[model samples]
Structures are given as structure tokens and as C-alpha cells.
Target chain A: MKIFELGKAKSPWILHYNTGSCNGCDIELLAVLTPRYDVERFGMLNKGNPKQADILLITGPVTKRCRERLLNLYLQVPEPKVVVAVGTCSCGGGVFRHMYNVENGVERVIPVDVYVPGCAARPQQIIDGVVKALQILREKGRALEVPPHLKKIVRGREGGIDRESLLEDLRRR
Target chain B: MKKIKVNQEICTTIPMGSQHVALPEPVKLVFDTENEVVKRVSFDVSYVHRGIEKSLTTMYDFKKAPYVVGRICGICAIAHSIACTVALERSIGIDGEVPDRVRAVRMIGLELDRLQSHFLINGHLAEVCGYENIFMHLWRCREFILDTADMLFGNRVQYDVVCVGGVNRDIDEKTGTRISEALEEIEESIGFMEEVFTRDKTLVKRLEGLGVVSKDKAFEYGLVGPSARASGVKTDCRIEDDWGMYRDFGLEIITMTEGDALARCLVRVLECFESVRMIREALDSTSPGEEIQLRVRDNPKKDAVCRNEAPRGELFYYIRGTGKKIPGRVKIRTPTFANIPILPHVMIGVRYNDVPPLLMSFDPCLSCTGR
Candidate 1:
């Protein structure tokens, strides 16, 4: 019934979160926005506030210190948000996989829509991941009557997956 | 004089790492504090220490050493590889004169690194200042420099351009012309950034004299790069060693006398200007010639130490080859190590509010420090 949702889905702003891996993926993620690759052509904007973002491009393996903050950030992004785990570290804890401190991959921390793999994940791969995420977002938005349990998971009070509870948590304790 | 005391009974000591909020890498910094103002800060840094030096010795052959060492510092991998390869070449006495074109490409990679690293640290410093907008702006500007690097080299961080003898890729006329145009825009952007940095009264107020390590003390602590230069020391490994194409194509090192966070920031800004000059000179003077790379010797036996002025400070790489598949030993003394030793001394009396900026002033990449 939403007539205007498709236009917004076409141009999804991104919020990049770095957990703990080497900064290689961060640099390559940046390269996607640069003139050469120019992922902005696909209507990607790097937004600072997670609340305003449509896609989350996570570039590192989640760490103990950053896990809570990362989860809080992911929850803040409104419904139909997609998570794109870019880089080997984020997809699966790359070289630092063995480290005791690394909490696991980005998916373990938050649900991931697209997984882009590379030691540092090339700019092209990152762009491809974003495109895939946008497609997933559109598909999810068009879905009809979700079952009751799925509704609770997506928009719920007890499960705490809803936006308002997440916002409340974002405020410093 | 007023003094604060720590109550060991009721106080909970936060064992903040092998990892902390400011660091991506694991390095333990034990804090004994009543609250946020750390009464005492002590740390242990062997967490991520993979015995990289030993690994370097056993894992890589001589030709493969540069790329392996490039993984040393993710941010400054280009400098690590360049310094190591240049040293290895010198040790084996392979006088593969770097063509002006290769020098230009190398300079582009190096300067772009300097631009990105400086902006990154400065943005992080702004975060300490609680100026998030400026932090975003600085980081956004850094993207342009990243794009420039990606265009020149295939990868953004690990360019993998520098081979044993010379640079791997050549700057074709179209790419070169495009890069020249990009540099013009980058310079203008930098000029705009300078205006913003200098005019931001709040930033200056917070950063000014916060972490003032005077010239004499800076020299005493053996700080290098802009950290040393900001203290009025004329010592730079680049000028002193005259390695790489620097001797042939001269460079002017930027320096200052304040030795504070502001002065260090100023040193980086001035150095960007210097880097721009060097890049311009290298580009203008470049002449197309023979192959950019020279054939590596089949098997070589030698031990060499090379030092370069990485964006952080002086990066020293020591390599010993046993004429085997792997290097005998590879030792790295990164800038953070040299700068970190001076931290406890500088932090002795500054207010608790000042510690973060002081840490940022040194541009401590804890990953590089621990690695």
C-alpha cells in the first residue's frame, strides 16, 4: 500500500561502523565513495547518525568494548534496514580470528544481509554488497502479512527488537 | 600543592585492555581511578605481539619480504615496505636507479598516506575536542586522498606498488593527467581545511599548550618526525639518511618550536604543504624511461637497518637474510614506541581532562605500537 517507499529504497544512506580489525577494510570502504569507484552513483551517502541510515556497512570483527555500542547503533536504524558486513574480518574474523578478544563476526553481533569477502574487501566488492543489500531491503519492504512471531521479532516489546527500546538504550546509562 | 589519594578498598580498578575504546588493537592499560580522571595509568603491550620479527625471519623469502613487512602497519604499510625494500636493495648493493616516474608514483602514494593519516589523527583529535562535525568533515576530506591513492595503486592502504628495485606500476599519461587535476582539487581542499582548523577558536583553546613538551625535553625523549620537529629539532630520518630518491630529488622538512598538541598539528599541516611541493616537483620533472623495476638477486645474504620518516614518526626496520626461503630476523621499532616512552613523563601533571588530547597529540596508533 506504500506508494513512496520504493524511491527511498533506491538511495539508502550508509552508516559505517569499525569494530576492531586492521583499518584496511575501512580504507577500502572509503574507496567505494571516492571518485574512481563512486558508489554515490548508486545513491549511497555516509550518514553519521545510525537513526538516519538505511544500510550499515560494518568493516571489522566485533570486539568486547565495541559490541554493545554496535548493537545499540544497529537497533537505532529504522525498520527495513540492511546490514552489509564488508571485509574478511567482519564477515568472518580474518587474520585476527584467533585473537581471544575478538567477539566473532559482524553477523554474530547483528543480522547481516550481505557478506562481502576479501582480505580487506576491494571497493568494487563493497559496492556490490551495498547493491545487494538495497535489493534485499526492497524485497523485505514488499513482503505481506508477516506471521505473529516474526512480527514480534521485527516490531516487538518483549523481544526488544523494536526501535523505541533501542533508542532508550542509546542514551548513556 | 594539593594531592589526590586513591582508596584501594572501595575503588574498582578498570583493567581496560589489551584493548580500549581508543585502540583497535589489544594493549592493556590498567587504570586506577576514583572515576573518569585516571589516578594512575599503567599498561602492558604484548597482547597482539605475534613475534612478527621472528615470523618475518621464518616465513618470507627476500623478494617477498617487502609485502610481508607492508602488513606491519596498516595505515603506513607503504612506508614500511618502501623503507624495508630500499634497505634490502642497499644491503645487496642493487643500484636500480629509480626512474623519475617511479619516484613520482612513490611520492604520490607516500604523500597521500601522509594526507589521510594526518587527517585521521586530526579528526580523532577533534573527537577529543567534542567537535564531531569537524571530525566528519576531516574524514570526508580524507576520502579524496584515498581515491587518489586507489587510482594510482590498485589497493588503497597496501598499494603493493613498490618492488625490490623500483615501483611496480607506471603512471600512464591519462592517469597522470587525471592525478594532476585531482592534486589541484586536493590542494584547494587542504587550503579550506587549514582555514577551518586555524579559525576554530574552541579547538585552539582546548589544544593550545595542553600537552606542552618543550624542545629540550622532546629531544631528551628522542621523539621523531613531526613530534620531534614540533619541538624545534631539525632531525628527520629522511634528510639524515638520504635513502630512496630523496637525495636525487631534494625535500624540505617542516618544523616548529611549540612542542604542544597544536604545534604537532601545525607540523603535520606544514608537512602536507611540503609533501605537495615534493609531489609537484616529482611530477613536473619526471621523464619516461626504461623499466620501473629491477630484477631481484636470486639469493642474497645480508643484514641491514633502514629508517624512514613515517607519518607517525621514524619507522625503523632491521632485516637479516640467511640466504634461505625466509629472512633470518626482522625487527621493527615503530614511531609509537619512541613516542609512547615519553607519555608518562608528559602526563605527570596535566589535568585528567587533558590526557585524551595529549594522547591524540602524539597520534598514538596503539595497533602499530603493539604490533
Candidate 2:
């Protein structure tokens, strides 16, 4: 509904972090930014800084050393953000699962909203996952606008703000 | 000439990685700089270590080792697989028994892999130099190579074509014709890129005379791949090790004496033309309806070493078999591992701002190093 929220859905800047990937999914993600499969046509730009990113695209099975940094990056992104885990390793640790140094998948460290599955996930699959992430970003934007408990009082109003309902809503909380 | 006095008190220590915009993988570098010029540098490449060598000896058997090693570095998956297969075959005492057709098909796979990997690093190097237009154009042309690879192997990044005894897929006449057509398009684009890389003053200005590794220094540091070749080291596993059909194809090693970032870029661009020619020659030499794969019955009982010329450099694999399905020990020495040690040497006198391009010139693939 708000201008910033609309902008957030329209152009979702991506922050790509490779926990311990083989560079397969990472290159494919880069290919998505290039001419042939350019996601820039949809206003998607890959940003290096986590603070400016709307979505975090992560590849590779999380390694022991990268787990701390991954968490740090996940916390740095402001709220109303989405996490998309690309490649089979990030989804469920495809071949690197149960390895000594790896923590299996990105889900072990952070919450993931979309899982793009492939050994080195193809560019088309990555684009589809990103599109799905945009919808999730829009939904998150809507959810962040109003708290769940205050929704009843905000919607029950006829013409003016009801003091009794507001008071009751506060008491219930 | 006056030598400036060194001052440790004025030098600043700056850490540039683990995660950065200029780097595709996770590699941390600590630079000791005095005023803007670097005095010394050190790097940490353990971030991507997945214990693949340990897993190969303990968890996976010889039959499945090729597929497992293919995941070591996705950029050169075929190279890894071929090296692993060669090691396994040698350990089983069947190294010289493979048919010519299988070798030809495998060579095609490796050359195509080299073509795309060179394009990737060149495009990435241009991007780090702030030349996004050249980067975009180069990658746009790279799609044809990937398409040819996809047509041949049925996968883009992880082409699991190599096996222990032979390769998995054979190129039919129809696919071979299509690949030839694709190579023609790729060659035309490569010509355009070669002109830009050689003549473009701005791109050359950023890379030339930076990170000069003298010929003696290259041999002293034991640099492998294009980084060493750029210094005129004349070290290529394709020639040094007879794992593939490079000898039969009369492979000409590309070398440059400049030993700077520009020379490294030029070596890769020039090598692309050789890759195209090799692929064409391989396609012409091999025919359809030939046997692509051979059956393997013996388990490895001896130690064998296989060296492969990957897109980055020489990829070495040492496998010790204990007359069982699982190997006794599997050790991998990737080219990046050999090339990374030379970074501190190269980055010592360079400016702080030129570190990214200098680092990119080596084409550091930490996944291969750490694995």
C-alpha cells in the first residue's frame, strides 16, 4: 500500500553469500545477472552489502567457519527480508552432506524461504526461485505493516478511531 | 634511485575478505600497507574446506569416486573427474588400455570446460577492473560454449561424463555438427574479445605492469596454470603428464613473458582459440557408434598419481588402493593450492586498490584449494 513497500516488491536487491560452495551455483547466479538471463530487466540488482539487500541468496553447504559469518549477515539485513537457498548443497547438502567440515545446508544456520534444487541449479530455476522470493517479499511487507493483535481494532473502525476498542486491544495484549 | 626507508609504525593492516564484492568465493586476505602500497600480504583459504579427501578414502568407493570428486570444483568438474578416473584406472593397472575414442571424447569435454572457465575468469577480471561493458559482452558470448557442453554432456556445470574405465556419453554425428556450429560462433566472439583485450587502452592500463612475476620468481614459487605460464614457466600438465590425448592432438602450450595481469588475461584469451581448435580436431577424429565406456572388474591394489591440466592449472590426484572397493588414501593437490602461495609474493609491492584485479588474474578457485 505504501510507496516504499511497492518499491520493495518491484526491485529486490540481492546479497549473495557463498558459505562453502563449489562456485557452480554462484556462477549461475551471476549468469542470471548477465545479458542472456538478465534479472536486471525486472529491476533486480545484486548488492554486496547486506544492509542494502532485500533478499539474501546463499549457495553451498554451510561450513564450520562460515556459520558465524552467515548468521552475522542474516542478522544484518533489516526485517521484511527473504532468504533463498540456491543449489542442491544449500537445499539439503546434496553430495557434501555428512562431510566433516560442512554443517550440511544453509538451513542449519538460518531460516530459508525458498529452496532452488540442482547440483548447480540452472539459471532458469534460479530465476523462478527469485520470482517466488519477490512474492514472499511482498507478503512480508504486508505482514510487517500492522501487528496481528492490532488488526482487529484497525479493521473494526467505522469512521473514527474507537477508543474503547483500542483500550481493549491494549489490555488484551 | 633513492630507497625509501621502511617504517613498520606507519604501515596499516587491512583485511579484505571472507566475503567481499570483488571475490566470488570466500577467501580472506590481510594486507600490510604503507601509505597506499602494500608491504606484505597473507591469505586464509580454509573457509571452503569440506574434507573431501578424507571422505573419498573413507566414505566413497572406487566406483563412485569420480562422481564424488566431480563436486570438488564445479568450474572444472570434468577435469576433476578425469583426473580421478585416470588415477583409479592406473591403480588398477589398466592405464594404457583405454581406447582412443574414449580419450577423444574426454578431451572434448575437458577442452569445452577450459573454454568456458577461461571466459568466466576473463569476464570476472574485467568486472573487477570496473569494465562492466566488456564483462557483460564476454559472458554473453560464453553462453554458446555452455550450450555446446550441454548438448554434448546433458548438463551445464557438472558434466559427469568421465568414469573410471571410460566416459559415460559419446558424441553422435548430429551433436558433433551442432557443436562445430557453436564453436564457430564462439570463435567469432573470441576474436572480438581478443581485439578488445589486446588493444583496449583502458583495460590494459589497469592490468599492465601490475603484479609482475619474473620468470625466475615463477619457477621459485612453483606457480602452476596460466599464472605460471604467464611468466614463461612452460609448465602445463597437458604436456608434462600424458593423461589425455593432448600429445596426439599436438597441443601447443601458450606462454607469455610479461607475467603481469594483462599477460595472464592475454594467455587465457589466446588459449581459447587453441581450445576451439582442439575440440574441432577431436570431433573430427572420433566417429559415432563407437564404444564410449569400458567395463572395470579389478579393484585398485597399488598407488597411482594422476595429473591433469585444468582450466586454472595442473590438478594432481594421488590414490593408494588396498585391493578393496575403498581406497587406502586419496590426496588431491589442486592448481589453486600451488598458485595461491605466490599471492603474498605478488601482492607485496602493488597498490592497495589494485589488489582485486591482481588477485583476479590468478583466478583463485578456493573450493578446489580447500577441498
C-alpha RMSD of each candidate structure in angstroms = 7.5, 4.0
TM-score of each: 0.76, 0.95
Where does model 2 sit among the CAPRI classes?
medium
Alpha-carbon runs more than 4 Å astray in model 1: A1-20, A27-85, A89-113, A122-173, B1-28, B34-37, B44-51, B95-101
Candidate 1 share of real interface contacts: 0.10
lDDT of 1 by residue, B1-371 (tens): 12345664333355654323444345556655554455566777544343346545654567777775665567888888788887777667674565556666777777778888887778778877788777667777777777788888876677888877788888777877887788887787688667767788998888888778888898788988888898898887777775646666678778888888888888887787777777777777775557788776545567777888889989987867666656677778988889888877776556666777787888876556655
Rounded to one decimal, what is candidate 2's iRMSD?
A: 0.6
Best by TM-score: 2
Q: How many backbone clashes does candidate 2 have?
A: 0
- The lDDT of model 2 is 0.90
- Each candidate's B-chain TM-score, in sequence, is 0.91, 0.97
| Residue B71 local lDDT, model 2 | 91
Q: What stretches of model 2 exceed 4 Å from their correct place?
A: A147-169, B1-8
Enumerate residue pairs that collide in model 2: none
